[model samples]
Target: MIAVVYSGSHYAHWRLADRGKTVASFRTSGINPYFNDEKQITTLLNKNINLIHHAEQIKRIYFFGPGLASNELKDIIRNAFLTFFKFAKITVAHDIDAVAIASCKNTEGIVCICGSGTNAAWYDGKK
Candidate 1:
């Protein structure tokens, strides 16, 4: 199973999929590393029934959010997920990276984001 998450300052959107079919989709409180610690993040995860039920079954996770501008910030979320998702290969990246991938996929394209903040980037199919 694979999980994809996109978080802003106010909410986190989650999608769990397996065999190219969606298993579940839901939302939780936002997970901004700058505003939340590892324990807080883990706590949020623990409260969600969807996550609790699927945690052990998920094999991969892709998380995107703001405030992951540095490796240190990314580690905050990574560490929290690590504690909860013991068997998954987790990836943490900037929310803009998500914009890139969504707009370009495996092709070259430019993406512009304008929500709470504004920025643009060029994706060469591989970041």
Candidate 2:
């Protein structure tokens, strides 16, 4: 089983799959490690009743969301995932990097994150 999630500032969407077939879909409020504490993130994640019921069934999870810019933030988000999905292998990433990597793949191009926290990178497609 696997799970994938994408989150922006306002919302997060979750999809769960088994043997490449989608089995469940759910949504929860955006969980930004920069803005939410453990308790708040836990509460928000609980809003998705399906996730709660199927947490243990998921073997892996890929979550992309805003505000995951530091190790502290990653730790915070990881803690939140561990709190609920006790058995899944979880990967949390910044939303922009998720989009960039998905779109570019092994092709070389520029990847940038603008707005309040602006960053730019040149990619050889390896790093």
Candidate 3:
């Protein structure tokens, strides 16, 4: 099973898939490592019924969100997810990387992200 998450400042969108099919889709309160601690993140995870039901079954998680540009910030999310999804491998990255990959992929291009804030990056086919 795999899970993909995109988190902004206000909410998180989640999709769980297994055997190439979607199993569950839901949203949870936004989790910003910059503003929320491990305990708070864990609490948020615990509050979600879908997560509580599928946490153990998930094998991999790809998490992308804002404010995760630094290793310290990334570690905060890594730790929280590691503890919650015991059986899953968690990969955390900045939202900008997500935008670059989704929009540019392997093509050299400039990607602009406008959300709670605006930013842009140049992708040379690979980061």
| Alpha-carbon RMSD to native, per candidate | 0.9, 2.3, 1.0
Worst 10 residues of 2 by lDDT: 114-123
On residues 9-40, what C-alpha lDDT tens digit does candidate 1 reach at each position? 78999999999999999999998988999999
Ranking by TM-score: 1, 3, 2
Tens digits of lDDT, candidate 3, 1-127: 9999999978999999999999999999888987899999999999999999999999999999988878999999999999999999999988878888999889999998788878898988888
The residue-level lDDT of candidate 3 at 47 comes to: 91
Instruction: Please list the residue runs of candidate 1 whose C-alpha ends up more than 4 Å from where it truly belongs after superposition.
Output: none
On lDDT, the leading prediction is 1
- lDDT of candidate 3 at residue 62, scale 0 to 100: 96
lDDT of 1: 0.95
lDDT of 2 by residue, 1-127 (tens): 8889987766788889999899988777777877789889888777777887888898898988888878888888889888988998989888776667876788888888664456677767655
Clashing pairs in 1: none
A best-first ranking of the candidates according to their lDDT comes to: 1, 3, 2
Candidate 2 regions with alpha-carbon error over 4 angstroms: 111-121
**Candidate 3, residue 75: how far the Cα is off, in Å:** 0.7
Write the number of the candidate with greater TM-score, choosing between 1 and 3: 1
Best prediction by TM-score:
1
Question: How far out, in Å, is residue 10 in model 3?
Answer: 0.7
